[model samples]
Target: MPPIALFIALLLLATPLAQGETDSSRSQPVVSVDFENGVLSPDWKSEGSGNATLVPEGFGAKSLLVTLPDQGSRFVHIPLSAESVRGRRIALSAHVRGENVTRPREPWNGVKVMLKTVAPGGTDYQGLMDLYGTFNWKSCGLITTIPADVTEATLMLGIQDASGKAWFDDVSLLVLGKLRSRPASPPALLPPEKLDRRTDLPRLRGVMYGPQGREEDIRKLAEWGANLIRWQFYWYDGTFPEKRLDLALYDQWLEATMAEVDRMLPLCEQLGIRVLIDLHTPPGATESRQSAIFQKAEYQKKFLEVWEKLARHYKDKPAIWGYDLLNEPAEGSVAPGLLDWHSLADLTAHRVREIDPHRAIIVEPGPYGGWGNLPFFEPIAVPGIVYSIHMYDPLAFTHQGVLDGYPVGVEYPGMIRGVLWNKEKLREILAPVREFQKDYNVPIFVGEFSAIRWAPGDSAACYLRDCIEIFEEYGWDWAYHAFREWHGWNVEVGSVKDDTSPAPVPTTREKELRAGLSKNQSARAVNP
Candidate 1:
């Protein structure tokens, strides 16, 4: 056979082999370029193919390299198998490192690589492929989806600038499943044994003087279903000692008050009652002085010292539910509003716990019982601490006839009329209490709420009835202002008598009102 004829036959045979190589390059699954090694593997090609060089930093090594213009981009394309990414959420991942780069003011401007997908029918989809921002070497990823109708795709990585060299390696495309959602937490369970315990246990019922006044009438209050009692203990009054700040006077007052308290303790204990012991100071005492007492550290020190003594004295007593840290602390009277009452209360409660862990502590909100402006229950976080709110709303109904110019004159507004007095309204009034329970799981006590004397014809009684009904419905325990007549007691029909003497006149109006309302269990024991 001739030589020319043989060569021509061989060339024809190699044509199919060369076509197979072209198809194999398009079927490769991963496309990666390492500028350090200057390589494009497995028959893959680059744009500007002639100018781009494969440089070797070391022997037997190759890396695909492109010298990029300072302001323009360099592009690379690798055709992928049509079957490799059909109907999938394709995630492209790569390791990137930047070298000889100008650090931009914003890190994000450092370098960006983007992946462009060309679909089977000549449509293009572009997504952020990966980013390299002043990183020594970092693993970065991008994600894109293959169109449902497209069977083939081409992936292109385009570099933004030639000033910064970026090397990408081990690039991959994968299909991922949907992410899982986090599970929800279960609801809390109530303690079974104490489930029936009243959430609203303390409601203000009545106010009574210290042991000096109307002891007999005060004793009768429990029978009227008064669950709470507020009794004051004064330092300068006869109960302690007049014009004496000595330790002996303090001890004498503590002893005398405790003896009296001991006598009343059994009465309240038997009646399932709670008592709040209020430490009282006259309108102008060293401790009561506006600026000095609460503002100065020494005053607060003395304040806590007094409470420490009291807490130690009644440490184990349960009938005494709490101690009223102060009474009607006026604006500018105590430490400024910002002065940490919660912390002060917490310190007192801490001392109380050291002596009596069981008895709850009640601290009034600052600025003379501003119930609506009460701070959140930070102090009451201690267990057995009850938040107390004193309500004398629309004070006209409470102090309608007072000569001293109290905020509310002694005109009882006859029950807070209409649905505003109903259960939902009651709930709204106690919304903070509910929130307190939800937040810190604590109980609330309305320590003092009452109408003064001379609130006209059965108005006080009607208000009392509404308050009692609402409180009872919510299972709250409460106390009335006063069980008997004092100078401030609001029994319009009752006559005042000395502390030791019987009433000069029988309370005929009280008797008539009580008889009319005594049908229910709560009202039945009125005269008992």
Candidate 2:
């Protein structure tokens, strides 16, 4: 199975209530600790080997000092009643400083404050931004929109894995009101320039092809009227949130991939299918949203080298669609000082352009490309490029049951937990991407979109149809998550939506996908 995307959030900022809106936040903060009197609050509890207590010195008058005598972990946190905070945008703010803190071995190992939600659905949705090494007092906070059904929320501050001393002061929780819809307008397109080549194709429609695919699959896709295929070079598949590939193996995998593509170019040309060479797993990618490539300078160097080699090799390949820079860049994980996803993408895109200026360049936003991340996405300023995203929204719905403890029996177009979700909800969630397209005057491409096969109530098929319809309505290009990649995602292998041991039979999932892709032959694209 491919690495599962780490679900993050979009914090809707508070705006003046337009006549009908009411504020749901409490007048007073839920918790505030000055520790001035040198007494820990009864509500605050300490867990793990180390301790959190009052110390003479802090960022201000007094602070809570967290110490780990051993090289283990420790934390101090307070649980909050969820009823009052549910369905609201909440911010966790604290003044923190590290003293002799060890450099982290894992991304989560550091001095930081974390917010955890105790909800029925088991997503690791939390406010966990790690800060390592020694530093002076600094103010840091996390903001997120909490779910309506969440039972409790916890705010924890301490050290994990590599233990050390840290100080926390002026801890407080602020509750903003519920999220509101951003007003929308019709999309505006930028006038064309010499470098603009977004119209290289009429539209993109197909699946992510990988090493698992047969050469003849190109023929099958063309027969079904698919014009594009995202050929993913995902060589590092052993771990779920994959680990860094060894440098020695990198050369080997790169060669093996080039050899395979060499064998498939003609068939692709003959079938009228364009190939999007996707470096599905790049350099030091990891399951953690904070991928190693973002944290390690060495990996960043390797990342550029991969693109340089690919652009040089495939620059002249007419059947190639574009180079998907990196599958999903690990955002917010650049260590203390390093390049960010945007910088890396800009650098790589320009480097590729120096060699080949005509092919469209595709780039995706990260912490993993959910619609939520789209709002924060900083578009690359370069031209002849398409912005990319991966859609599996209502994540608890589309990717149901795949992640352990995520809610089962989830059906689409109905209430899940306390939210009424349907096609309109999908539209609301995607408004950011739509606004992005309009604001930037650039084209959008969905690199991957799909759901699990075992989703109940034909939800998988329904979800697919809804996603495709939205893509068409917006005139965005797209490719399904997979074809012949894994049986779990393969619509062809499943006869029934709920059959645990699916047998070979035509399915609604496949039918909906076929119907959607079939339209590409008749219509050029909503925009094109």
Best by lDDT: 2
Global CA lDDT computed for model 1: 0.48
> What stretches of model 1 exceed 4 Å from their correct place?
1-209, 213-215, 235-252, 266-273, 282-292, 331-339, 375-379, 403-434, 490-528
TM-score of each: 0.50, 0.70
lDDT of 2: 0.70
Write one digit per residue (lDDT tens) for candidate 2, span 1-528.
111111112233344445432232222355666656433346666678877666678755667777887787787777667764676555566677887778676555678677778666444445444576677876655444566578877777788876789888777666543344433664456432211345446667888888655766887788777888898888745543323547667777778988888788888888778889998777765532355666568888898998999999998998987899988665432444556666678899999988888788998865466555555455666777788888887677766766433556788878865667788988987887888777767778888898887778688899899999998888788999888776768877673445545456668898899998888776554434
Q: lDDT tens string, model 1, 200-276?
A: 23333444446443445545654444556677775546433234445455556667876777777776777666677
Q: Each model's number of backbone clashes?
A: 28, 1
- lDDT (CA) per prediction: 0.48, 0.70
Q: Worst 10-residue stretch by lDDT in candidate 1?
A: 1-10
